[model samples]
Target: MNEMKEAVGNWREAKQFSPADENDFLRWLDKADTEEKLFSRLTFWFTFRGLPADQNQRYHLVQERARELRLWNGLELKLRRWQDRVADEYEQIGKEAFAARIGEDYADYINSLTDPEAAPQQAAPEPETAKPAGVQAWSARELSEMVLPPIRHVVEGLLPMGMGVLVAKPKLGKSWMVLDLCLAVAQGEPFLGFPTQQHGTLYLALEDGKSRMQTRLRRLLEGRPAPANMHVMFQAQRLGEGLLEMLGEYLDANPDIHLVCIDTLSKIKPKAKPFENAYDADYDYMGRLKAFADSRGICVLLVHHTRKSKNPEDSFDNINGSTGILGAADFTIVLDKQSRMDDEAGFLLTGRDIEQCERVIRFDKARCRWVMQGTAAQLAAQRRVAEYEAEPIVKTLRVLLQQGDGTWSGYSKNLMEMGQRYAHTELAPNLQMLSKRIQELQPMLWERDTIRYWYNSNGNAGRKHNFRQERADNNASVPVSAQLSLRHNYH
Candidate 1:
């Protein structure tokens, strides 16, 4: 293969090709170790030459090679992806023309290829009998009027019955969570306060030994007996090697199976080729699993890890791999924590079938299971209130207000001195940070603690702040006008 690549490179550099070069390429293709490798090299060469025109000599050479190798499925996969990516542009060029270039027979078979993302077209309903097969088109009105079954969920309102990725930092209880999910589904139990459908489940514990899994299971079960329907495997073949076929056989043997969990995606995924685009590699690998799951109408949850650096704007961006993984999935669940030491973590869920949700879950160390705390917004507000009560500056302000007549008006410098004298910890690094913190906490303070803070900067005298405590009974909510003026006055 290396020699073949060098030969192709020389021909490309010289901008010339002869019968001898063509013979050498054909011979190398025959010597290729596997069909997948041959396909990879061919596509790399094709793409390197800028996806040659249909009439070009190189394009014909590739088509002939693909035909001789019987790489119709590979060609079809590429065409589908290209058609999907380029959409209207591909329609303009014609899908049949592209498939026919590979081979005429493949063009006929292309329509039969299952696209998980594409809706199946059906003919108009008959007067009595069901619509006959081979009806490929549907008008917009027909599509809109067609009644489809609702998407099923393995875990109600959280996980839909399709392929999904569960991502979190390593050692953040992802394995534990999925293990619990398997048991819950197998036994028809509620998981994290949500009801789960009872079904057979397969857990691919590729990274853990039986002993470790047993220990975790025992811990989770406590006095209860383990469910008989949940099966676990310690090792498996890589995806292309035999993983899918093995799973198919397993499903056939256990016809009741509805959930298959892979501990870590990296373990079973095939090794990527050097020439393959990172995004394309992820999409292709995940797309295969997605197709298999959708066809079986089961839930396949892939356990994955998040990137070290966080994306403040988007939680999904923190997923370790390229966007293709999320792009190919039906849904994605990300588990995030502000700190590993904290017992509570945010569980984010988003997908096509389910509405987006964010929940706060706390790890119950005793049972080795996550307990639902509440909605994310509620928990966040509670945390803020707790923080405000314990904050040194707030404590210092309370003491000063109590020592005085429940009102303090002074410059930030004076407040800093008073805070240091009265408070045990430093209020902040400097007067600037102290002022900012006070303003940042204004809403919480005013709304929760009946403390109204007003600060303004004077030209040469520096910033002056006025803090007054309102009667607890009189405090209801911060006025809209005051909330709007909070930042302005602080600035």
Candidate 2:
């Protein structure tokens, strides 16, 4: 394969923002104090290059592409910022004026340069073709009436009605974690801090027999009534061994089941045929599983492994197989250990329709469940220092935001006041500490007016903490799962 080129052109090519101040660019773009101003800044992105003729090419679509590119903050905003610095007379005239005058000529230059931020456009159009099988266009009202994916919080954003994977190195207790998930869904109990929806859950213990599974369950249930809804299969037939048929028939029998877990990928992995491609085999297996999940609106959790050199920065990079398997799945959840021995660990959750998260966890031998220990910062990563250090304060605000209509608006002073009330301080913290905490939780926090706002993506947190309520702290136990706000920052 040829080495991939940058979207614009080259790295050292003509540019607006210097590489020296990229961090400053991100911080500046995100520093808006109000929602109106933030949206205004957002508008600048489209205005610079005329908004896309196709609606899908507009702000949201391009922004999604930026995330895929890992541009840090808002993609268009960053691009616009760069343009402001680089475009001739950008500061003297204005972005709209400069962009209109330059347009594709600028792209022509970038085509010759190395700008990774550049978005490539096709010169020649492909012939129009009929939509693929079962793919139908949606009418406006049909789309409006259709349930979009975010009616969420099945285990509070970890499990949903599409494909997802849970990965960890061997002996990191991934099985215990997933077994806890299945057991939680089966019994309508909480998984970690998140509430379970009480559904029949299938656990394909492909790597373990019934006896071992029984032992694990006893440890999890700990004398509580075993959820009859929980179903277990000691071993699974290989992919071509009627696995799909058997699983489909089982779902047919138990229509209420919405979750199926495969303990480890290797067990049920089909043997490769002569001349078969490894990537194809991996992707094909996952596609079959994903199809089953999507067809029935069920959740499938595939337990897999991470390679030795796990990328703490991006969990997807550490997955042990071809990129095709990742392409086939909806998202991934990766668990990693600081050391091979029983030590501190963290799990990174990233995928389509799931809010990205990485958090510290400790396994409790007595309860046989992972406890929310802290943020991944405890594992000693230096990036995103604020999120790492002020995780508790950020989570408190997350709970507060979710208690109301999943949003809040307040001046910095008001926010600090609220933070002080919720802060689990042994000695009352200063305004600076509280203010610093709010500032650090930026990805989850937004500004709209003179007021700053934030929300929980799962949609069911912090309603009781409405800023308009003139609310008192109610003196609760720090918003744990048992306390309220399952989606609150457990880390």
Off by over 4 Å in 1: 1-135, 308-312, 387-491
Q: On a 0 to 1 TM-score scale, where does candidate 1 land against the true structure?
A: 0.56
Please give, for residues 1-491, the per-residue lDDT of candidate 1 as tens digits: 22322333332321222112233344433333334444433533342222122114444444444544456456756744643554464367554433222222111122224333332333344454333353334556645654434667889998897899999999999999999999999999999999998888999998999899989999998879999889999999998999998997787567577899999999998898879898999999999999888756688999999998899888899999899999999999999898999899999999989999889899999888999999978987888889988888888888877776677788988888888798866888988898889878888777876788876668899988877778754454555655556666556
Predicted model with the maximum lDDT: 1
In terms of lDDT, the poorest run of 10 residues in model 1 is 102-111
Cα lDDT computed for each candidate against the true fold: 0.73, 0.59
What is the alpha-carbon lDDT of model 2 when measured against the actual structure?
Answer: 0.59
Q: How many clashes in each structure? A: 0, 25
User: What would the per-residue lDDT of candidate 2 be over residues 235-304, giving only the tens digit for each residue?
Assistant: 6788888887888767756756778998888777788789988889888888988876765556788888
